[model samples]
Target: MSISPSLDTDDLDAREVTDGRYTRVQIGAERAVKVRAAYTTRFVATEFTKRPEDFHMLAGSEVHPEAGDVVIARVTELGKHTRLESPTSRRQLLFVGQEIMVAYGNRYAPDQFLAHVPDSLEPCHLVAGGGLAGYVIETHASIGAATAIEPIGLLATREGVVNLRDFSPLQVGSPSLAAVAALGSRRPPVIAVLGTSMNSGKSTTLACLVNGLSNAGLTVAAGKATGTGAGNDPNLFIDAGAFPVCDFTDFGYPTTFKLAYEEVRNLLAAMIDEQAAFGADVVVIEIADGLYQGETSRLLRDPLFATYVDTVVFAAQDALGARAGLDLLHDAAVPVAAVSGLLTASPLAAAEASAWIDVPVIVTYDLCRPEVAAALIPVRAALL
Candidate 1:
C-alpha cells in the first residue's frame, strides 16, 4: 500500500534532514515497538531492501509483527504532544518532517480503540500510545480519534526483513518445557490475574499483590503473560517492587490477539519458567483483556496453562461482569481465588459482587496489605 506524505509547510520544524538509506526519526510511545527497548536502542544499524512486500505492513496482514520489527514511517501528522512513550515508559517528542523507524502491529482495547492491519499501507492512524500504527476499525467514543501516520515501509536487510522476532531474547526452545518441569519443587507458586475486560483493574490489582508480597519479604517475579504490547502494566509491577518483570513482547509477539492456543500456552509457560528460574518465591502474572477474549479464553481452557497456575484472581468492572466471569471460570473448572477489579472502587459494587460470587471481594487498596495477600495464597497441598 502507498500513501502520499502529508506535509504542512507552515508547521515544519527547523531540523536538518539527512539523506540516507533510512532516515532517523524519534520512535513513538508504542509497546509493540518496545521489544527492542527503542527508547534506548533507538535504531539498530541495519541495511534495508526496497521491496515493500519483503517488509511487513502494520495493517491487513496475517503476519504477526514482533515488538521490535523495524519499519520506516513518515511523520504524516503531529499531535498535541510531540513525545512518544518508550518501552521503559519514558516519553520522547517527535519532530515533523522526520522519517522514523517503528514496529508494525495491531492493538485491541475495549476502552480505547480496535485497530488491525490496514487494508493497504495507505496512511493509517496510530491507534495506541505504544506506537501501534494500523487502520482504526473502531474506537471508544471517549478516546475521540486516533493519531494519523503514514507508512514508509518495513526495515529490511539483504538477507530479509529484520523482524523483531529474529532478535527476540525469548525463543521457543530456549526455556525448554522439560527443563522447567524438572525444577519441580523449585518452581514458585503462580497467581494469575485475569479480567472481565481491559481497564477492569487487572494490572492495578496485580501491582498491589506484588507490593504486598514484596513487603512480606517474598521475592516476587511478575509478568504479563498475554495482551497487546505495552509497558504500562509490567512497569507498574516493577515500581511496585517486583524483582523482575516481563510480558509477551519479550517472546517477540507484538500483540497476543489471534495467536493459536498452543502458541499462547507455550509463551506463558516459558515466561513462568523464566521467572521461576529467577528464584522468585512467588510469581504474579496478568493475562490481558478479558477471560472471553479469543486468546484468553483458549488459554484458560487449556489444561497445560492450568498446570502452572496455583490460583486465579478474577477482575471485573461490575457485579454483572463478576457474576458472568465467575460462571465462566467455574465452567472451565479453573480455581477462582478472589473477585476484584473496578468493582472494588465502590463499596456498594464490591458488596454487590461479593453477594453474587462466593469468593472474597478484595479491593485494590486492601490487596496491598501483606496479610491480605498472604491469605489469598491457595493451599499448597490442594495444588498438589
Candidate 2:
C-alpha cells in the first residue's frame, strides 16, 4: 500500500498501531469522518480515542452509521487511490498502509452498494462513498466489487468505549417535550418532498423549491429528514439558496432506518423546530426513499408528522408511479399539493399523470418558478 506524499508518516506514531500502547490525538474538524458527519452537526469538536477494544462492530447494518460513531479498521488492499467523499462533502485520499477510523452504516440507493452490517467482527467491504464500513450483501451490477476493509477493533479511551449514540444530542424516549410543543405551536408552513423511490427526483425537486422560494424573496430552510450520510443532498440545498440546511445525520443519526416511531418523531420535531427558529418563511423537508419504504411509510402514518407538515409534493419516476403514489397518500389522508419528479422530464408522462391526479403536475423547470412555489403554500385559514 502507498501513502500520500502530502501526509507525514511520522505523525502517526508507533504507539498508534494495533499493538495498542494508546496514542491520544485529535480527529480534525476540517475534514469530516465521512460516515460520522451527521454526528458532527451537533458535536463539532475534535474527539480523542486511544484503544481499539473501546469500539464494537454492531450487527445488522440496517441504518447507516451515524457521524461520530467510531470504528477501527485496517487497510487490506489498495484501490485506484480515489478521493473519499467526506461527511462535509470534501474529497480526500485514503492510503492503503494506513489504519483508519470509520463508522458502520448501510446505504439504499440504486446506483450504489446495498450493504448491511457484518454479522461478525471480520473483514468487510467499504460499501459506501461516505466510508460506510459494512458487508456488501447486495450490489448494483452496474458497479463492480466493493472496497475491502478489515475490522481491527472498537475505538476506545481511558474512560470507556465510544459509540456515536453516546454523543447524540437527542435520546430515545427522552425528547425535549418543550421543543416538541413549541414546534407544534409555532410551526412554519412546511412543504415535504416524497418520492416513488430513490433517485426519483426528490433532491432535484427540493433544490427547485428552495431556489424558487429564495428567488421569490422568501426566507427558506431545507432539510433531508432521512437517508444515509452523504454531503451531496445537503450541499444541493445550500447551493439552491437555503440557509441552515440539515439532514438526519445532523441529529446524530447515520440513517433513520428501523428507528422507533417516537424517536423518529422527536428527531423530525427537533429538526423542524431548529429550522423554524431560524425564522425562515418556509421549511422544505425531503423524506428519503419511496413512499412505501419503511421509514418514509412510518412517518407518513405518524400523526405527529401530519401535524407538522402542511402540504406534500409527491415525486415519481413516471405516470404510473405518480398515480400509485398519489393513491397511497390519499389513503393515508396525507394531502398532496402537487405532483413532480422524473416523470415531469417527459411531457407525455407528465400529461398522463396530470390526467389521473387532481393536483398540479410540475416539471423540473416549472418547479423552479416562484409562482409554482407560491401556489403551494398552505392558506393560513387551512392551518386553523
TM-score of each: 0.80, 0.79
Q: Using lDDT, give the best candidate's number.
A: 1
lDDT of each: 0.68, 0.68
Model 2, 278-319: lDDT tens per residue? 678899999989987787888888898888898899889999
The residue ranges of model 2 lying beyond 4 angstroms of the native Cα positions read: 1-45, 48-68, 77-82, 165-185, 381-384
* Model 2 vs truth, CA RMSD: 7.5
Where is model 1 more than 4 Å wrong at Cα? 1-68, 78-83, 176-185, 381-384
Candidate 2 has a TM-score of 0.79
Measured with C-alpha atoms, the lDDT of residue 303 in candidate 2 is: 92
